[model samples]
Target chain A: MRKIGKQEIEDMAVGAALLGTGGGGDPYIGKLMALQAIEEYGEVTLLEVDEVPDDALVVPSSMMGAPTVMLEKAPSGEEAISAFKQLEEYLGKKIFGTFPIEAGGVNSMLPFALAARLGLPVIDVDGMGRAFPELQMVTFYLDGISATPAIIADEKGNTALLSTIDNVWTERIARAATIQMGGSVMNAMYSMNGKNLKDSGITNILKLEEEIGKSIRLAKENNVNPIEKVLKTVGGFELFKGKVSDINRKTETGFARGVATFEGLYENKGETLQLRFQNEHLIAQTENRLLCVTPDLIAVLDAETGLPITTEGIRYGARCVVIGIPCHPKWRTEKGIATVGPKYFGYEVDYVPVEDLAKKGVTL
Target chain B: MRKIGKQEIEDMAVGAALLGTGGGGDPYIGKLMALQAIEEYGEVTLLEVDEVPDDALVVPSSMMGAPTVMLEKAPSGEEAISAFKQLEEYLGKKIFGTFPIEAGGVNSMLPFALAARLGLPVIDVDGMGRAFPELQMVTFYLDGISATPAIIADEKGNTALLSTIDNVWTERIARAATIQMGGSVMNAMYSMNGKNLKDSGITNILKLEEEIGKSIRLAKENNVNPIEKVLKTVGGFELFKGKVSDINRKTETGFARGVATFEGLYENKGETLQLRFQNEHLIAQTENRLLCVTPDLIAVLDAETGLPITTEGIRYGARCVVIGIPCHPKWRTEKGIATVGPKYFGYEVDYVPVEDLAKKGVTL
Candidate 1:
């Protein structure tokens, strides 16, 4: 097991924000929170799913709601532990460990803070290798794990536990609660045994975050392109390099969804790309065709600092580079495609692997 | 203590509907459901607060959401029990009895139904002697009793446990859940011991319903004014006796709020009166003066059958009699006025006791 300290938390925030694809809420505040937690509680232990005992109760959790709202009404840090303790009390069992529900955005750092506070180890894997908008959009859900019997808690010491007919209902019910609880809440759910996590979890997510962060840092030191380094280290594709020229944002059904148009720079001059999002960046499009679609990774990073720009923070003048990575093998299956494919997001086209799209030059 | 049989359920629905003041949702379905449970599990026992053991766990329950939705999507009859059982499991103890959270519409009968299913007794008392729209509008809340740790369940066997700072947060969180769970849900909350109920409850509400029903029935048989009989029985006042000339309804913030206008009939011919409501009849008015307001009762009953008309069932052309009952002495307190008064419902005028208005004779 590895110990995640302040430095590791910082690096993971950078990497997770990149993987956030412009959603999953803002990571800056979450990073600060985690740093404070580490300062108070020392290092957090990280355990692989296989290393945990078979009887261990592992809970995966994240913050649910509009990322922009998180910036305005910050979490009290106690919200997560309140939800966790409520679930523990209700189930009449101790939670053996905590883990990230997804590997992207603020969620990826919340568990670290939670682990430090609770004095528990965090599982080395995540439910989703990257973030998706809805609570049900997770690899564990796709693998047949239930999301019910979940606990929701707000800053005001209010907590709710849910056991829905399905994960979809879990998302629907929890979203409403989150909205009513001032548009943000911490959720602890999908209480599975260690054995189940080993079977369904996206393994090596922490390691992947580390590699992505390390690669970017090294590239920066060497005066090389951070986007190229991120792509090479994670086997991702550099989709576009551009300046954000136009953007549109609207909240629909309790989610912030919009499009960000980027004007290409350097060799790709005069070309434009559009990124569509609902919490998470869902689709990347060229004028004529789709460049990439989730559960494939779409990361938007600052051209200079190598820092990631959250969707809520994406303004009209920021320079950014877009990168795409192949989803985990599990998410490439028929059911996975059905859950988070282009069509699932209301796009007309079928899924085209990001690697295939990256080979063609911007010949136009 | 007494056992409430099928006949009592029937009578209580009638009286409860009168007290609902056109809001508590349709009582017909709940009445039928209670009858069915009585057939299956025999008559449910009813316990007075004073008769219970101090340590016995007492849970109050009701349905939350738009009553109109409950009409289209019939309950599975297992929703309340599911929540109850989940609470039992969570508390790690057996709940000795159940009670109505409010003496409004369907809530008045749901406890009987749930009791029959769970082999538990229904308490003779409730948190509210009559219904108000919001969850926190109960006497339990007004008396400083917390609404959590609460449980919410859907027909599909899903359950949620909530722990809020106060009853207001509980209502806010649960209302959102109700809306998402197809606009209605069964909630079991305010789990207290017998002593707590003795302190915060509106005692003998079931007996009050029984008295109201018997009074209306006797009035109908004797060919006397049923509204007058109701007033005498409950120590109420005749707010207006008229023909329903105009009615308007609109859903706001998840509660059906509207106005019902009545043209005077009989001895009070040629006068006009208006009854305003949000879930329940909250205001009684003449052309220029306010007659009564909540938590005082403002019931509208059919002129002939004396059957109460729910707010959702109020129409443009039904002849009706409006009766106003004095609020419980508890509700006469300053805090109670703040909790459920004309001002609380966004009215311009202050609250006036019903008897005072009835004495002045609808003077021009």
Candidate 2:
């Protein structure tokens, strides 16, 4: 377990932004918040899941709202603490640790702030191990953990506790509350004991995220293709390189959702790629076939700057590269396909591994 | 409570169709499923909450999916039963009765099938008295019952048992599974013991639904305005009477989410109303002020036919009447608004009582 310095966080901010693949929201604000917390409480220990005691009670917490809104309505430091403190009081147990929800912009950094404030280690793992739009779209769901008794705290010091019958309702009701509270609020949810956490969480995901982030930073500094470094670090497959020609977007149910139509810029020039997104890319469709599907990580990065572009940030005429990384092996099984594949996103395409798609383009 | 027969079932179906507010899909299918189950088994007894044994283990079950899909792909009756049976096994206890998750549309009738097949009585109550998009967006969620141990059964006889840490995860993961299986799947979730049921269930909601359904039927047959009858039955307030001039819809995050813009047709001509919806109506806004906000049920119905228009069914040139019913008084409290109100849905407007809105000429 490494004790990261303030300098590492700066590097992480850059790398996290690349891994965001255009939609984790700006990491700058969350980075600042986390840095301040670390300064106030000292360095946070990043614990691997194995290092966690079998009997320890760890809760995964973060902010749940519009990232676009997060940019406009910055979170007060109090909210993160309030959300965590409320859960601690409700459980009548000390929180042993915390962890990032994903390896993205703000979400990746938000947990570190909580851990620093609470003087607890941040777990090196997340449920999805990647970003998803809704609170319920996590491996934890597949593993049988509930997101209820979620604590949501707004900037005004008003705190709300939600214990739903299911995670979807937690998102639904909490979403409404977030909107009511001005589109963004800090939430600490997915409370569970260590036994369930060990059973459900993706082990060492933080280390993986940090590595993914670090590789991109190193690649950028070396003037090499960050995409290649990402692929090497995560075993991701380079799907296509293109220039974004047309971008269409709309906010649906508070999700910044839309599509980006890209014209191939490299050897694949004149070939168009269409990527659909709802917070995160779900599908990458070419004229001939579907290249990447859900559950697998689909990201689009600026060809020149290597900056990740979010759905809301997509605009006309941005050169980009599309990459696909294989999800956890468990997500490839029948259960995984049923939960987060192309068909799950309303596409009629079958699940195609990123490696296969890289070697042989998907058609039909 | 009145014992529902085949004849009453038909009337209830029609009433539910009108109450569905252009969503909830077609009630005919749920009616058919329930009728078939009752026929294969026997008549289902509807017992008031008070009549249920204190020790009776009542499970509130509903099928969570897109209503449009439910109409296309009829459910195999086995899923609910399988879920109930599985939950029974997990609990190591026999379930005494069943109840509907909601008392409107297909959800309202599904419990009958489970009760008849299980030889258990159906309770005269539900979580939401009307329809909602996600399973977890229920009153039960506010009351603190988990939707876990949820059994999701597909038409292919593939049953996935999910035990999530929260309800949101339950909905998210299950929804992914349902979409992968096809567009829709059957779910028997929020299985609660009678003690929990008594504590969490909305007492007498089934009876209220029946009464609401029957009143609409009687009003229609008597050539009276069914909307008025509905309002009188539930003390609802008229929010707006308008013609749907534009319906903008697109699918996002696996949900048919969009906005329907209405132009007032009668006394309020020249005024415009926009109702934003994901699965259920989340916000109602006019040019001047917020007409109605969530947590207060906002339903749209055909002005002439008195039939409800679903969010998906809303189209250009449709004459519609928007109604705002007071959600259960429990929802009007501070906690309730925090859980289900306009603020809950991300509206800047403060929650105005439905009755107050009616008196304020749609500007409240």
Candidate 3:
């Protein structure tokens, strides 16, 4: 195990925002929260998944709701502790460690904030290698892990402990309650033993996020193009370079749902790109080609700084590079595709690997 | 203490419906559920509020949703038991008895259904002497009794255990989850010790309901007009006699909200009565005069048989008699009125006791 100091947190936030794919909340806010916690409580220990005993219980600490709401009403830190305490009380056991449920600006950094205060280790594993909008869109869910016996606590001192028949039901009920609880809540869910985590989780996610962050940070000093460095680090393919033309967004049913349109620049001047999202970027397409779809990670990066821009941060005139990375292998399975593929998100496209689509110019 | 059999269940259902004030669920369905439970589990024991020991734990059994939805999706007995079992586990104490949270057909009789199955005593007490739409509109709320550590369970085996800052948050979160869970769910909330029940609850509500039911049933045998007997038994006043003219209802946001209009008949000819409700009747008015308003009870009954008709049961041409009864003295307090008053429900009229309104002929 190693300590996660302020520098690690700062780099991780940048990388986490990249992996968040335009959802998971603002990285700046997430960084401030973690930085503040570590400032007060000192550095938190970071444990590899295998460091936890087979029987020791681990839970992921994350937030659920529209990212826009979270921006205005940042958590006060107490809610996360309250959720963990409530879950422990109900489960009749102490949590051994905590981890990010998904790789988002807020979600990826939240565990560190919580771990610092609670003195719990931050595990290196995560449920999703990249972010998805709904709670059940995780590799753990594909492997049949239950999300119930879940606790969601709001900043207002209100909480709801849900026990649902399936992970989907948990999402439906929890999402509704989240909206009523002021559009955001801290969740202590998917409590499982180390054995289950090692079997189903995407391991070394934090390491990869930190590496991605470090690559972006050092690019300027090293006299290398930051976007090119990021692309090389993540093994991602450049889909398009464009200037934002328009964005249509609205917060509805506890989700930030919208589409962003881009006018291609430089190498692909005539093409128009459309990116659709529900909390996270789910689809990216150009006029005649399907660039990428869900179960694939799509991220928007500032062309010069290589810093990821969240869906809410996309400005009308911003120039950006859109890239796609293949999701974890677990999401390529038939069951995984059914859970979060294009069809599940209401797109009619069939499942196709981003690598294959990048190689052969798949027509929409 | 006494044994509550099928006969008592049948009588209590009618009385509960009248007290529901056209908002509680249908008495027929409530009677059937209690009767079926009694048939299988044998009679449930009824305990007086004073009979319960001060330290004994008690919880109320009820349902929250649009009444229209409950009609289509009746709860399986398993949901109620699941809710109770979950709550008991959370509190780490055995519940001594169960009581009704409110005086509605389904709310009142649900206690007996659950008590019989669990072999627990049914307490003859309720938080509301008359039904109100929101969970916090009760005497218990006015007395500062908490509704938390509450559980709401759906027939599909999903349950939510909520602990909120206050009862109002409990209602808001639970109602949203209920809608997601399937529009209706059984609730186990407002848990308190027996002493709190004695102090805050309306005692002997079951006995009074049974009497009302018995009076209606034996009216023909006693050779008296059922309406007159009902008025005498409950000390209520006739507000209007009318034939139903129009009803505009829609179930939205987990509440059955609408208005029903009536064309006057007999002594009330040429007058039009308008009744507005959200789960329970909240107001009644004529063009120039205000007839009744909550927290006073406004019930609609069959003009001939004196049987109560639920908001969902009101038909376009049925002859009916609207009656008004003074709520328990507890509900007349400043807090109680503010909790369920006309203003709270978005009505502009000031609250006047039904008796005062009846005697002075209050203008709109």
Candidate 4:
């Protein structure tokens, strides 16, 4: 295990934001809070899933709700600790370690803060390699893990422990409760051991996140194009190069969903790239071709900084570069596609892997 | 203390339905479930609040969500037991007894069923004298009690334990979960002791429910005015004797809310009464004067059968009688009126007790 210091939080947040795919909630506040917690609690240990014992209980903890609401109802730090302890007491087992449910924004950072507070390690993995709107959207759930005996808590010291028939019910019920708990809550759910974590979790997303963050930081220092650096580090490709022209966003079914349209720039002028999202960017298309979709990363980055520009942050007249990363292999399977595919999101298109979509004029 | 047998179930259902106002969900399935449990478990003991040990843990248990959905998800009779047992496990104490959270429909009967299943006594009292749409509207809340450390469970062996910032948060969050739990969930909450129960509960509503049911049954058998018998039994007054004119209902924010209008019959021929409700009847008025409002009782019964009709059960051209019963004394206080009064229900009128409304030609 290695210790995560202050500098790692920014790197974690940056990578988490990129993986956020335009929704995982803003990481700015979480980054700051994580830094504060680290400063107070010394530092958090990062433990490999392989290092954990099979009998050790590992729980993933994070904030769940609308990103917009989460911004307003900033947690009191103690919310997570309280929830974790209470959950432990209810489970009658001490949590051995913690992990983030998804590789995105605030959630990717919350477990670190919780681990620091509890003197435990943050597992070096996550349920989803990228963010999705619902609890059932997680890879762990797709891998047949139950997201139950969950707890939803607010800073007001109010906590709710939930056990549902399935992960879908967990998401539905948790979302409603979050709306009432001032629209945001801290949750500790999906208790699994090392064996299940290794089998169900997306392996080494923390290393991937750090490496991705490091590439951007290095490129920025050397005044190089972050787009190329980001592409090289994550085995990704450029989907579009453009300036955000028209953006529209709205909240639907307890989720922030909308579309961001971009007018091409440089070599791609006169072409339009349209990005549709529900919490995380799910689809990218042009007037003629469907470029990428859910379970395939659709990340919009600041043209100069390579910083992730979230769905809520998309504004008119902002330059951006869209990148696509191949989703975890598990998400590309028949069940994965069926669970996170375009059709699952109400689209008629079939699942076409990003690696196979190279016939178009975009950079690979 | 008394043992509640199958004979008392019908009377309880009848009176509970009356107290349901326009909603509390249909109690038929709940009655049947209770009867079956009683037949198997023998009978449930009804314990007085005073009989409970001062330190005994007492949790009020019931179904939560739109009453309509509950009609479909007819519980497997294990939901309440699961929730109660889960709550008991969470509290880490033996539940000395159980009580109904509200004096309406399913909630009124669920405790007895739960008690029978668990071999525990059902307290002959409730948190609310009459049903209200929201959890915060309970007399326990009005009397400065908290409805936290609660548990919600569905028939699929799923249970959610909730401890919110307040009863209002608990209701809002729990309702959202119930909607997701297929629209009806059994919950065990408000784990207070005998002292708190005596201080906050609306006492003797179970006996009252029995008396009202018996009076209507006897009156109907003797071919007398069942409406008068109902009033005489509950210390209530005739609000209106009419034929159903129009009933328009719709669900809003998780509560079954609607307006039921009646055209007067008998001696009050030409007058009309419009009842507006959200879960329970909250307002009663003609074109001008307000007849009776919330915290007070507003019961609509079939003219011939004297059977209580729920909001979901209200239909066009149904002949009915509306009776107004004086609220529990605690509900008549300033705090009571403020918490569940006409103004609280969005009416622009001052609350006048049902007895006082007699001077205004409405009820006495």
Instruction: Point to the candidate with the largest DockQ.
Output: 3
Per-prediction DockQ, in order? 0.82, 0.03, 0.94, 0.73
Tell me what fraction of the real C-alpha contacts between chains A and B each candidate also makes. Answer: 0.96, 0.00, 0.96, 0.92
The TM-score each candidate achieves on chain A is 0.94, 0.93, 0.97, 0.96
lDDT of 4 by residue, B1-364 (tens): 8889998988888888888776776677778878988999989998888898888888887877766666777787688878777777767888898888998877888887777888989898898877877778888887778787878888777677887777877877788777767777787778898889988888889999898788888888898988778878888887788988998888777667789999989965888889998888888888776788877889888988788888778889999888888888888888888888888878877878888785565432
Q: Model 1 segments beyond 4 Å from truth?
A: A304-306, A315-319, A360-364, B361-364
* Model 1: per-residue Cα lDDT over B1-364, one tens digit each: 7878877887788888887777887788889889998998899888888888888999987888876777788887788878888888777899999899888788898888888888888888888788888888878877788788788887777677787888888888888888778888898889988888898899988888988888877788898877777777788777677988888889877777788889989965887888888888888888876778788898888888777887777777888888888878788889889988888889877777778777864333
lDDT of 3 by residue, B84-147 (tens): 9988888889999999988776788888888888999999999889787788988889999999
Worst 10 residues of 1 chain A by lDDT: A355-364
- Model number with the top TM-score: 3
Tell me the lDDT of model 1 at A143.
81
| Sort by TM-score, top down from the best | 3, 1, 4, 2
- Point out where model 2 deviates above 4 Å: B1-364
Candidate 1 vs candidate 3: the lDDT winner is 3
The CAPRI quality class of candidate 1 comes to high
**How well is each residue in A1-364 modelled by candidate 1, as lDDT tens digits?**
9898887887788888877777877677788888998999999998887889988999986898876678888887889988888788767899999888988888898888888988999898998788888888888888889987788888877888788888988998899889989988899889898888999998889888878888778888898878777877778887888999998999887778899999999866888999988878988887875678888888888889776787778889888888889988888899899988888888777777888778763322
Report the C-alpha lDDT of model 2 over A201-302, residue by residue, as the tens digit: 777766666676677777778989777777787787777888878988888766667888998876878788999887778889889967888788887777
Please give each candidate's TM-score. Answer: 0.94, 0.53, 0.97, 0.92
For candidate 2, the TM-score is 0.53
